[model samples]
Target: MSPRRHRGMLLLVLCWVLLAACTAQPTTEIAGSRPVDTSARAMLGDLRTLDPCTLADTAALQRFGAVSNAGIVSLDYCLLHLKPDDRTLIQLAVGELTGPDSDRPGDPVVPQGALNIVQNAPVPGHCTRRVRFGDGVSLQVSADLLAGEPGAGLCGIADAGAEAVAGAVQQGRAGHRDFPPNSLALVDPCAVLDTAAVNQVPGLEEARPRPSVGGHQCSWGEQSADAPRVQLQHTAGEPPRILHGAAVEEPVDGRRTVLSVVGGDPQVPLCSAETGHIPFGTVAGQVEVAQLVVAVPGETGTDACAYARGLARLAWPNLPPANP
Candidate 1:
């Protein structure tokens, strides 16, 4: 075999071996940054800056049937509209820091380029294929279907979408979003909040920062029903309002903010402090906001609202300010 062809075969075999290992022993690792395929990384550049919508190729998706790009529904994913049934849809999530937790052992695996794509166990009306490129990071392609009215296997559809993404990377078709200088979409939620900030909240001094799949949201402390936790999210939305309980208007980093508390269990109360409108990109109507929240489950003499507000004050200034 030619040297190039031999190398391709070796890489394909390696992908399958990794997939077998993953199915034999499921991973329990937390989601975070990890090294991935060198070639993919070189082609895609920084994942945090890449535009997820670039992977949702309309021409590629139309192979299944008539499909329309619905644009991006979130910072990390894009939605596509499929025809012939209202119950069928497709979602492509990129730069996701972790594969879906729902993935199970023995889930079907397929090799796509240098990645091992795992087809998650199907739910009642959904199927997902996760293309894990890094230790915990992956791209997810999902299909929503209604049973008994099916045209194609949901998993097969998901795989097709995954193939498109892999091909895009191979062909260097993936692109980056041109975020404004101050866009919240560029912020890493995990970096703004530190251990010392979390330590301010009683009983959460040792809490570790766990970033969401997209790295736009962060949570501290164990994810349990009774554990005290702190969460911070940077998103584009309308200004905050009084949704529950009484709200107090406050200023954090010279920005108008709303602080509110919601009743949960007597021992654990949920409190949140959300900022007023800050400028994001024009695609989201230029409105951006940050939320700092706390939920305490035990008698720690902690005022959830006060902790959330105080954290907000410390973290708000770190966010990129709008240009004059």
Candidate 2:
């Protein structure tokens, strides 16, 4: 085999092996930084400048990697990237509390008041760790290496770096940044649709973000015609949302399902989906979910509601989820 091809195969094998090792090997050897006493929720808000690319102390850590930040920081997460090279880099995302304590393994966590930190199972060319800010939020950090040349020491680097960042957050230390004006403006609305799901509805084949009577809604329809389209809109109001708390279904019928289809207007066939919060990403504060509406003149109610549920499945996962 050519030298280049041989190297590629070897790297793939190494990654598979490392990932398997990460599955359940909990370690106590992980180190901790100075104790930080703070709530995860409060830290998230103080992370006023949530740029990971430029951390508070990037100058001292030139030995390993330079800093980089990718996405906007919000109440849910602040994603970070530390680049040592193309083949090796590190990532960290501080997230809100996901669920009960059983979500992660019971590893030794160095308690810094409300802060909780633990090393997670490793992934290919990566070492993952968790730093729970008090009881309500978590800091997920990972070290990534594309090739074995970067070596196995990545886990340690990921762990120490995560601990330091977690502490920095607790102490209200973050890079200077200008926060966005609207809280729910961070995520791309068009990115949430299931390509396959939207295509199943005839005429309503294209999906794009557009404003409608109900505020900012995503529309899927023929570029040539306006009717015969399915759209998902966001409305924050009181209860009785069409598909509120309804399980996702196919070929949504007016008779049987989690919610009997809201058959109020013959002109607009629609359903409702409520945003209940276990964890809502960008749509956390949203109270009600308006079902996908099919407004094609000749379309059946079944097709309209089906398109709504299909679109709901795609959109629901992206919304800040209600409680699990």
Candidate 3:
């Protein structure tokens, strides 16, 4: 999401300055073509209800003072919290390990009943553990224990969390198996926006995968890890659920700005400019409704919002028209 071409130009500022102020659409249920097979194929659907906040059972990681520090969940990614914040603590990311990348083997280890487990240190001081359950379920944990509450045994704790996630998914999304239905669950995020349009962003001609777990994160920026010129996802609750009745903020350009304070969470930076608002009827109004999200890391200045808004506007003409 971003401002129109005429938002008086973008002002470049530091990343932290984006804490200024904002608001944050809706409805759709695209049914899948695959039949429900509970034996081994149902795990992904069951994951929709997995709350990242409670994914790691307290009893499992007893030795540590691990407590929820505000976790965010979506259709594909979850970022669990670790207490005693000091920039160093527990970090967990659980997401689908599909595509050709999952087949590539790495350092070996074995978790109970897991199809494959690979533990690797991508960078110094950081350890990442990945587990693949035979049912196409892959979970990962990355730990860089700096100066935090439970500094030691970060890897072990992450593994425990991974194990817990597997068990939880097997137990079936906490009995919320039949959720309200996420319209964008099976959508291919790349298809949401046109490549030609995405190239319009100054430094985004090259796109990279978001280095985090949760949601399908792809950024159009330099290969510099989290630095994204434009980022996109179709995950659950990342942009927060849009509620009716409240008037959504629409600026003079007809573009919706995704402010930093969205849902009162300064961490989420996004903006959206949509065409022809259509009330969600049975929710599945269009492909972009709840299924597609465009964002900026809020690194520069207000262009993060403008970029998001502009991208949304550029991609709109290509999107399916609103359901009448």
Q: Pick the candidate with the highest TM-score.
A: 1
Ranking by TM-score: 1, 3, 2
TM-score of each candidate structure, all chains considered together = 0.68, 0.40, 0.54
Off by over 4 Å in 1: 1-40, 62-73, 80-95, 99-105, 134-136, 143-157, 211-215, 237-250, 259-268, 276-278, 298-304
Q: Can you write out model 3's per-residue Cα lDDT over 1-324, one digit (the tens) per residue?
A: 122110101111111011101111111122554333322234443443434444446566555556553333334434454543445555445443332143345566675442345665455445566655444334555554545544366677667766765576556543322233333433344556676777766556665433222223334554332444554444433222233222144532342323322222334443433233333222343222332233456443345445655666555444333342
Task: Summarize candidate 1's per-residue lDDT along 258-319 as a digit string, tens digits.
Answer: 77664322234666677744544456543666767677665422377778788888888887
TM-score of 2: 0.40
Question: Residue 132, candidate 2: how far off, in angstroms?
Answer: 1.6
- lDDT pick, better of 1 and 2: 1
lDDT of 3 at 316: 42
| RMSD of candidates 1 onward, in order | 11.8, 17.0, 12.0
* Top-scoring candidate (lDDT): 1
Residues 1-324 of candidate 2 have per-residue lDDT tens digits of 112212222222121110011122222222475443344334554332344433324443445676665333223234456667766555444332232232356555666434667666766666766665444345555555644364647776666666676667656665443433332323334455555676666654564444321122445553223355554433222222233222343222221212223333433344333232222233333232333444444654444556555566666666543332
Q: Sum up the clashes in candidate 3.
A: 16
Ranking by lDDT: 1, 2, 3
Q: Which residue pairs overlap in candidate 1's backbone?
A: none
